[model samples]
Target: MKINLFPLLFTIALFYSCINNQSNKNDLTPKPYKVSKNFIPINKAPRIEYNTFNNITQNQYSFTNTTSNQEVSILHHLDETGFHFYQGLKFKDNNLGVIVGGTRLRARITLNGGKNWKEVSFSRFANSFQSVDFSGNNIFIVGASNYIYKSEDFGKNWSVFDTKYFFKENQSRYQKFKYYKVRFLTEKIGFIIGEHERHSVILKTIDRGETWKIIKNNNLPKNEKGISDIAIISADELIITTLSGKCYKSIDGGVNWQLLYSGENTTLSSIAFFNSRTGFIGGSNNVLMYTNDSGKTWKKIHMPYGEISDIVIHENNAFITTSFQALDEAKSFIFKIDSKGTNTPLPFLTKKDDSVFFEANSYAIQTLNNHIYILDKNNLYRTIIN
Candidate 1:
């Protein structure tokens, strides 16, 4: 016998081939990313119960104390401007403020806090202005069609900069670009976030608003959604929320970014940080999350069914505004979240049937002194917080 081992060798080769094929098939299968276990359930979190009341006759609103039945009037001022949809509100100080909006590119200024507002005219190249921010006397407003209007005299005059020049190579590929938010970390450094056809772009201005440079393409995440909001913790550390509920953090002054948190398929509209380690993110579908360890982990807080339009932190407390709309109903609410994660709904409420209520859309929130100014679709509301 020649001790032939051909059949045995063939069997061994066939077995190894099957194992290799099975290994590759396993590798191709998708695996779920592990969500953090830091979320606090609604039942376990501290919640305050307060009654909301709106007095149509007095043009005021009030919230009842959670512990006591004492009614406290919160509505300090309400400006009912007809049909003008305000998109962004910012206060340069306790007295000077500016609000930019749509409905033929309207801009309003108030010198006496929120007590009175007057329309300020500006040259219109875009139909709407989405965001407004100020660095000293230089006010920057960004809007549709890649237009950025800068006013060195505080909305007295305007100079427009078409950001399309930054994207000259792909300008013809997209019809228009919309800038959602403009944030100035300091007088000389600022950022404008927007998208051209759902692809997000961030522009950095190092020399005030005179010039801008696009953040390097390789430095940003490979996201295809718009950047909804930016939270600047410091000149070097910053965080941004996206339309698809993604959060990115840049510690090197927007030079390099890393994905901080992946949201649960919601649109994160606003993000604000009270300190370097504490932050809050709000978005669509009642998504409100907080992080205490910078951006390392996040904990979701239970909120009423509504979309969070804007968030602002005052005195270490987060003030949130929410708007909910449906075919037959519309509602808006203001809530406050303390540092301990306690949620208290401020007594401000609006209904579709109200004479002053126009639409339950977005609310731009700002805090000055001890008051919160909210710019709604057709009205401006100022509420005192103590």
Candidate 2:
């Protein structure tokens, strides 16, 4: 039997109370990045389809090698029922990878890249794994109800723990904080961003996952809008995005903060730093923002697609996926762009017969060995960029 638990922790963020008791809410402003008003024409990648049991259809996106102009693709089918849906993807190497999703503590691992995958579900009810992160051999999976499962091995086995806690003076109820994203700066230093009681919460762990403590600082946001994601650029530098499209930065750990950007009303779901000097943040309604000189300033990067889901940055290329809140069978797209110059979103086809594919939510985007992997709903599509 699975253990069902309710969400315990909540948050209330207070926006803009930087150090020296100044309100950055009136100061720091974001500049809009140059974007092409014209949409780049997108062509569907050549694909091979397979019919599996239970009326499931598998799609393989094949593309001709740009250099050789020869078609190339591969196909692999997973028990679509095992994961229900894939929410996160993390690859340890070119071969080994893990995916987490579903209302339960469901996870799947692949040892030989993605040629094959095996289901590895936890015994407890985890309410859908929200995020999967790793560092060296440590694998951490966080989800609803403040439950956190960790694996020291290469996702072979797992251990479960919770971030539930109660303030000393107000111990009437057990306040559990549900974590959305976990980022590790080092083996022992890491941070988890989530919500508690409609406000934002940031938990830090110094002794690995053995114990965690809440980081209470006055400079942080204290409103009903919760934090969407976090990017730890360096040991002292940190940036976090909010549901209101507001961005905050801290140069001295969590001591002092500055409101970097505030203009949009949509949630910024994903954030990543290529380095301490370069970063990207994206979320609902074509909201893609970039920073060059750390978090001092930011600008909106126009994307052809809206409702940005996931983004993974390679050396000179950036892979992004977009999807909607309401699930639709028609719309799903994964975009690849050359970050060195101006780029645009590349559209994709979900149904071969229908040229009008647009409402599916893309969950994860990954790249390995020059091949791109995109997860939409229960189907996984693979393609190679020429």
Candidate 3:
């Protein structure tokens, strides 16, 4: 869900904020100006080159070919600093990720998919980066504290969003906790769920991230256990699962929720919806549960024998990422399915080990602009789903 930002947090300790509202709209979309200068696209593959600025030679942007492979380009480096303080990456027309500043304590933001970067004092003195998400061309970046910042025009300018309107936590979990996952269904509507009892929070923004409202702890079946993840079905329906195998469907956004699927002892980590009645849930021990009659009842499907971390449904396509090894493979995997949980792992990117830690093991996946994006550590990579 997020990469460690400890190194970057130290780097950007002295750095402060940028322009408050909006300024760098120009920095994100440098197209129509120049081709070979502002931005570059990986055709066959992008040549791996060392960045002298930071003296790092890691794969900044990777596009697989014959020798390379068929997996979409997965971003590996963000700061180019020997210290990898990569937080998360976002893919629009261009890809953007965060880097840590070495001179002062500040995190640098990179665009054009890590080819270039700009320093932004976004994460200052943060213990860890909880989670990051993109909405309304605005970047909502959160860390170990109650801090949350929004970037306008890609990563050029940023503004802080006061999360106190919808959040109230006095325990150390709120002060020292980190976010595990974030999701944005619409620019103005979405949710972010994380760890800790009270930290298993849910937020909704009708006016983008300009403001937030907490819908957790509301009148529900039970809201004690930590939430694993959430998937939006519609304006009135959203499917959420907890680590206790408690699966709930919210017919009124998140205001009121009801149980759709449960097994008493199933630790469901991920859930996705096709329309309203059709959905799937993934949990511990390679378990996959499906509901065809709109959450009325569910039956388990034998998925790949492994720890299924997350699942995504688009039309008839279901993309799943495996966390643990099936047996002793130990390496992470990606599988695609149609309607049912039966899926074939994409052979192109399945290697012994990837450049980044979890390129093959990542759990953060977002679809935008007709492309599926995955965030492994601080790098963000994308591909046109074919």
Task: Name the top lDDT candidate.
Answer: 1
Q: Estimate candidate 2's RMSD in Å.
A: 17.4
lDDT of 2 by residue, 46-71 (tens): 11111111222234445443333444
Q: Candidate 1 on 153-218: residue-level lDDT in tens?
A: 755445566665665555253357788899888888899997877788888887876777778645
TM-score top scorer: 1
Give the Cα lDDT of each candidate: 0.69, 0.63, 0.56
Model 1 C-alpha RMSD vs. true structure (Å) is 18.8
Rank by lDDT (best first): 1, 2, 3
Residue 273, candidate 2: Cα error in Å is: 3.1
- Model 3 C-alpha lDDT per residue in residues 1-386, reported as the tens digit of each score: 99899988866763432442224653553323111211121121122111223323345455542323556665444434333344343444455554322222244455556555555442324354545677867777654444455666755544454444343433222233444456677888767665533446666767676666667656654444667778777656777888777887777777777877776667887878777777788878668887778878777776644566767665677767655523344333556667754444342234434444443334555555556665543455666666
The worst-scoring run of ten residues by lDDT in candidate 3 lies at: 33-42
Cα error, residue 364 of model 3, in Å, equals 1.5
Clashes in predicted model 3: 12
